[model samples]
Target: MKSLISRLCLYASMLSAIFWPQPARAYLGSFEEQDGYRIPLDGQILSTFLAGDAQFYLNNIDANGYTGVVPLGTYPNTLGDGTHGADLSRYNAGEYGTNHSGPGGTAVDITDNSGLWRALAGGRLNEDVNAPYYNGSNFTRDYVHAYRYSGARTGSAVLNLLASETNLSYAYTLDARDLNGTAPSATAANLIQMAFWLCPSDWDDTDTDNILGISLRDAMNQTVFQVGYTGDNMLQYRLTGGAWQTTSNRMGTAGWSELVVILDTVNNTAGIAVSAYDDNTSTLASQTYVLSNQSLGLDADALTGLQWDLRGGSLSNGAASFKNYFDDFNFTVSPVLVPEPSGMLLAGLAVIALLLQRKRH
Candidate 1:
C-alpha cells in the first residue's frame, strides 16, 4: 500500500506538472519563451538579435552571451561613430579628438563589425582590438557591464532594441559600482548613469534633451530619476520647474545599488524600485516608489522607442567624473502571470512523498 502511494504521488505530480511556476526571462532575448529564465541570452538571441560594437567585442556570433551579470556580443551598427567610424562628424562611442584611420589620435584596427565610435557624453573612448571582446559590454542577453574608462565609455558593443525589444511595461534594473570595483562610496560624487534616448535613424549628441535615466546622486540632476548614494540611497525625482522631491532611502548598504523602473503607461505611472547588493547576484533591501503623470509631458511611446545606453565620465562635469561599472541591465515587458494553487499543493505532496521514500529506504 505504501509503495502504491509513492507511485501515485509521482503520477499526481506528473499530472499537475502544468502548474509548475514559469520562470522569468530576460527582456532583450525573451518574449514568448518558456519560464524561470530571467536571462536567456543564448544562440538564438545572438544570431537573431541586432548586434553593435565600436571597440572591444567578442569574435563570432557564437561568442556572444552573458557572463554573470554582464552580456557580451558583437553588435553591428551603421549609425553614429560605431566601432568602425566611417564618417568622423557623427557622435561616436567614447571620446574623440579626430577621425579614424589616422595618427596622433586614439586609434585601433577596425573590423567589418567595428567602427569609429567617439567617447560618450564628453569623454574619451578606448578598446582592445587584439582580443575578441570589442567594448566592455547586452539582453537577448541585453544586460551589459561597462567601465568608466576603457572598454566601456571608449567602446560600445550594443544590442539593437529596434530588432529585439520590449515595451516600457516591464521591470527594469541597473546595478552599479564605483570604479574601485566595489560599491560606490556614498560620499563620493559618483557621475555614472544609464541613459535611454530616442534612436531615430539619425541619433547624435543633439538628442541629449530627449534622453533620460537613473543615477547615483547627480549633483547637476542630469535626469528625472537619481539618488545621492546617501544612507539608504535616498531616491529623488525631478519636477516640472527643476524642483526635486525625495522619498525613503533605497538600498540598505552603500557599496552597490540597483535602479529599478516599471512603466505603467496606461495609467501614466512609473513604479521605481532599487536595492543594494554585491557581485550582481541580486540586490538587497529593495524599495519601490510610484510616480504618476509626472513625466513632464513626455510621451511613454517615445520612452518605449528609445535604445539602451551606458554612459559615464563627466557628462562634462569634472567633479561628477569618476570611474563606474554597471551590470544586469534589463528592459522588459512582463506579461500577467497565471497562478497554480493546485499545482503548488501537488508539488508539495510530491516532495513530501519523495522524503518519505528516502526514509523508508
Candidate 2:
C-alpha cells in the first residue's frame, strides 16, 4: 500500500510538470512598444492626444469647447520634386506637412476646442508663406480651408468633451491622383494601408482590371479589420504577394459591412475573417478565410502600385479608384512563449520519482 501511494504521488507530480503553463515572453516588434502611439481610450483628456502640450491644450477650453489647432508638422514625400505633379506635392513634406495628399491638397491640424464646428482647418498656401517652390509652376495655390472634426469632437460639451473622450476620429478627402502615384517600399518601419475588394455584380476577367482598393506604402504591418462594400460585389483580401482571396458571404448593396484580418508575422500568413453587421442588430455576420503557405513574396515597396502600368479605360484613366475608410484600426505584438524542452519535463519527472522512492523507503 505504501509503494502504491508513493507511485501515485510521482505520477501526479509528473503530470503537473508536463502540463504547467509557460510564461509568455515579451513581443518583439514596433507596435508592441510601450511608448508607441495608440488611439486614446474613452474619457481620457484631449490634450493627451497631441504629441505635446498635454495640459495647455486641455486648459483653454470654454464651456462650449473652443480651443485652437495644434500643428502636427509636415507630410513626407518620397518621390522627386514635381515628378508626379503638384497633386503629389504634399508628399514632399514630412508626416504632417502643409500639403495634404489623400483626397485634396488639405493639411490637417488638431484642435483641443470642440465648440468650433470644424476641428480641422487648412494651412496657408506656399506663396502666402513665401516658401520655395519645389515645382516651378505657379499652381501652388492653397484653397478649400475647411474645418473637419473627429467623431469624438462632435460629442459632449466643449470643455467636458476634451476631458471625457479618450479617442478622437478624423477623415480627409482623397482623389484619384493620390492613388495613381508610385507606391513606396514596405519595411518593418512603415505603416501600410490595406483595403478589401468587393465584386458583387460580375467577376468578368475583362472588368477585373480594377486594382485592389487597398494601398500601403510606409504603413506599419498590423492586423486590420476591413468592411466589404455593399452590392453584389465579391469580398477579396490581398496578401503581401498581391494575390487576393474571396470571402464566404455574398454581400448585398444594402449598407456597409465589417471583416477582420489577422496578419501573423511568425507564420507569414494574413488570416482573414468576415462578418456582416447592421445598425439594428447585435448579432454578428461573419465568415473566415485562412490563407496559409502564401508564396506571394510582395516587397513592401511594390505594394504601392508604383511599377505596375495603370489599366486601360476608367482604371487606366485612374478614375475607377477604390475608396475605403478605416476606424478602430488596431494591432498588437503577440507575446512570445518559449516552450520547455521535453528534457526539462523529464528532469522534473526524475525529481518526482526520487521523492516517491524516499517516501516508500
Clash number for candidate 2: 51
lDDT of 2 by residue, 1-361 (tens): 3334434443343233223442221110011112111112221232223222233133223332432221112111222121111111221211221122322222223222221121122222222233222222222222111111242212121111110001111122222222223222322322222222121222222333333233222233321222222222455555443444555454432333444433322223233445553334534465444332233244322221211111112332223222222222222222112224664566667779999999999
Which numbered prediction scores highest in TM-score against the true structure? 2
> Residue-wise lDDT of candidate 1 within 1-361, one digit each (tens)?
4435434543343223223332221222111111001112322221112223222222222344322222233222322234432111122212212212111232233342232222222211122221122244311222122211112211222222211121111112211111112222221211121212111112212222212233322222223233222112344555334644555543322244556444422222234444434323443544333342234333222131111233322232211111123333333332222225676567778889999999999
Model 1 CA deviation exceeding 4 Å by range: 1-120, 125-233, 239-241, 250-254, 276-283, 290-299, 305-320, 334-361
lDDT for model 2 comes to: 0.27
Local accuracy by lDDT, each model? 0.28, 0.27
Clashes of 1: 44
Worst 10-residue stretch by lDDT in candidate 2? 157-166
TM-score, candidate number 2: 0.33
